[model samples]
Target: MTTYNTADHSDFVRQLYAFAAHIRDPKKNPCPEALEERRMKIYRELFYNNVESFISSSFPVLRQIMMHERWHGMIRDYFANHLSHTPLFPEIPREFLKYLDHERIAQPDDPPFILELAHYEWVELALSISDEKVEIATINPKGDLLDGIPVISPFAWSLSYRFPVHKISPDFQPRAPEATQTNLIVYRDADFAVHFIEINAVTARLLQLISSNDHKSARTLLQQISVELNHVQADVVVRGGMEILSDLRKRQVILGVRV
Candidate 1:
């Protein structure tokens, strides 16, 4: 193996980082004087355009709702400032979600539901591309959901947002949060189709319970929720929850009992 001089290696690494920084934010950082402007221009456009395209596809609705200047401005900020942890193109949206969640502060021009909308869009993309697979042999599909433990699918994600992100679109963007928080479950069905449905608080709580408990029967889980709610009729809560479980099973949100 041929080893290079340590000082030369360090200088090369520094030059490489400087080249990347200029490409990432050309307005703020100048490229090396030795580099050709035409070649650097191509690199800048190619890098920024690729990132922008992935982001546009991931959050199509959000893209449609925002003005071009505002949307591209946000994307540019993410491309320039976000320290993305992944090198894969598919994971770029996840990095953008992190930037919105932690790094980028909300601006006066940003939609009130910007973060929630981005998160909602990211869930659909995540479920579609997730590698988690269910083993059919381990699950007893015919088992009684109420009498036996029910298994929530890894694809069923329970999300609670301050705004109704599912309903936001170019035509119906709300300016303020609604009267109540919006609860939703986004899941992938047997056909590999991803779907999102608005759910009530009770249904969201039931999904949460199914996710956390491996031994509790559906009836027992419902009873716990009833006690938490201080409901006058525990039996009524159980009955309602059982019906909801059956519906969720039909949707493939509950994969079956852990048998």
Candidate 2:
């Protein structure tokens, strides 16, 4: 009997990886032409269906908004070309987001906010499954809402996109805003379902400051915004913004201060 040497074993392993890649890409396969054709039909159906299901569950609205052909084509392109970080099924959605962030699939004719909308759609599933646990610190929720704030939850993320993604609908297909920017807040609430909040520029900046532990007072944050929108009153802005912060606190989204 002949024994396979290390070099032979290595070659076999390399080919296995290559075969897996080819199975993933409908354009490539290692089997004989007739057999390869049959195998590919099964491979393509299973691979595409799994990814499509994962993405549909994560972004139902986005899936609904896209034409079936367009959605299938995008998923096929992603499965064949995008490099995934994990083989785990649950991680596929995150990999899909990573693919969108890096892949410039947005055509000029496509909605300007297509990528943002995809992300907005994915945020809910990502937060629902996020394993990161927040350690809520003790702080006086009633304590001067403006004074010496601590930290935001690691699980909470604030984002800005150039498109008003939240407004997208089958009827209201969005274009890039004339204003040039839109802001969003994605946070896990006490119930653990992710909530998406559309916020204005000032509130976005204030949350950014608080998240960064900038140690700035609410007045200072409003003043910073006031500098941009000349002639606006900091006091009025702070008062309005505090209401948001207070609500965030009540929801347990703001995880209290570090002190």
Candidate 3:
């Protein structure tokens, strides 16, 4: 009997790849009409339905807008083209969003804001399932609230989008706003449920700077915003901004400001 060497194993591996690919999509195989045709139908349907159900459950609102055919087509294309990072079925939604971020789907042209909206939509469940716990260090609440650095929760996310996705209603499918952008702060409250708050540019900057571990004083943060606005006196903005910071600290939104 002849022994099979590495070259023989390599040939076997290539053939195996071909066989598996053919079984995955039997239409790609040049097998007998009866043999491959029967299996192709079952395989295709199973693949399409599984992905469709996964996406539909995760993005019910997006599913509601598209017709059945259109929705399934999107999933079909995603499964066929997108390179998934995880083998776990539950991670499919995350992979789908990753695909959407890069792949142009076959529907109403998804605006730039659509990516952010999808992420925002997905975050509710993502946060619920996330295993990473935030360990916030203790801070003196009565001390210089601005002096202590504020650390936003690791799970918390701040997003600004061209469209007001959160405000989307049955009657109104939000289009990209022409006037100004909207900012949203998504954070898990003390109760552990995720909450979203609509915030202004100033507040967004303040939170972002604090999260960045920037060493600027709360007074400096306000002064910077005031100068950027070319407002009257810096003290007025600083005083008001400190009050806002104090409220944020009280709410536990700002972990703490070092004195």
Candidate 4:
């Protein structure tokens, strides 16, 4: 006949979290003593492997370049430290990006382009499963884009990063940011295939203006760009912008003009 401490149950739960935390990053926390070593090892491996699999699938390029030890350490730190806002498994990759953006401090050995590359990879995955919808009937695929209001596709995104994220790979990681910014548009086509196109500063600004949906026609938007850019030849700028709009329509980035 023995009396159990009321705190014992709570203590066990706390210890379980502690042990799990330690399993994620042993350097930062201690292992629980209550669990058998063999069984704890199994729990640790199982949990770490599942997380590693998700991260690896989401960021295949990052995984290939990082040595196992460093990659595992980074993942472990994320698992242990980040307090994710969402509990959904599908959002883990996005949450990991948030952690990298907001929480993770840069390590001397870590590539400077790591955050940008991770963001680029995450955007691909995010757009792939996006539930956003648009009505095709409202768009005029062959409309005069210059005079008509250009409607940006719901699936299109114009992203600018300090690093040339699209080009970074294991073999071509850059230690420093390029002098010029990298501007890219990632869009899902009619076939549902996601693709990215590199664009210049003016085009990037034009997309931003179009996204405002301010009841401005494509010609007006282009004019605004030309004025803001202080181009010597506004008509030339507008004409070039018109061609760009036509190409964007073909790519489905600009979902034609609103009728």
lDDT of each model, Cα atoms only?
0.88, 0.71, 0.68, 0.86
Better of 1 and 2 by TM-score: 1
Number of backbone collisions per candidate, in order?
0, 1, 5, 0
- Candidate topping lDDT: 1
Q: Taking the tens digit of each residue's C-alpha lDDT, what string does model 4 give over 173-225?
A: 88888899999999999788999999999999999999886588878888888
Expressed as tens digits, the lDDT of each residue in 123-201 for candidate 2 is: 7777788888665446544556666564666667888877778778888876547466778778887677777777777
Residue by residue across 56-142, what tens digits does model 1's lDDT show? 999999899989998898888888888876789899989998999899878987889998999999999999999997888889987
lDDT of 4 at 111: 85
Q: Candidate 2 has what TM-score?
A: 0.80
Model 4 lDDT-worst window of ten: 1-10
Q: How do the predictions measure up, each by TM-score? A: 0.93, 0.80, 0.78, 0.88
lDDT of 3: 0.68
Tell me which of candidates 1 and 3 scores higher on lDDT: 1
Instruction: Tell me the deviation in Å of residue 107 in model 4.
Output: 1.0
- In terms of TM-score, how similar is model 3 to the real structure? 0.78
Q: Give the local distance difference test score of model 1.
A: 0.88
On residues 1-259, what C-alpha lDDT tens digit does candidate 3 reach at each position? Answer: 1122235468666555554454444444443333466776676677767777878888776766556776666776676557676888878878888888887553565444556667777886677667776554455445676555555666677788777878664455766574777888776767778878888888887777676665767767777889988989988877877887876655656666453
Candidate 3 clash pair list: 147-258, 148-257, 148-258, 148-259, 149-258
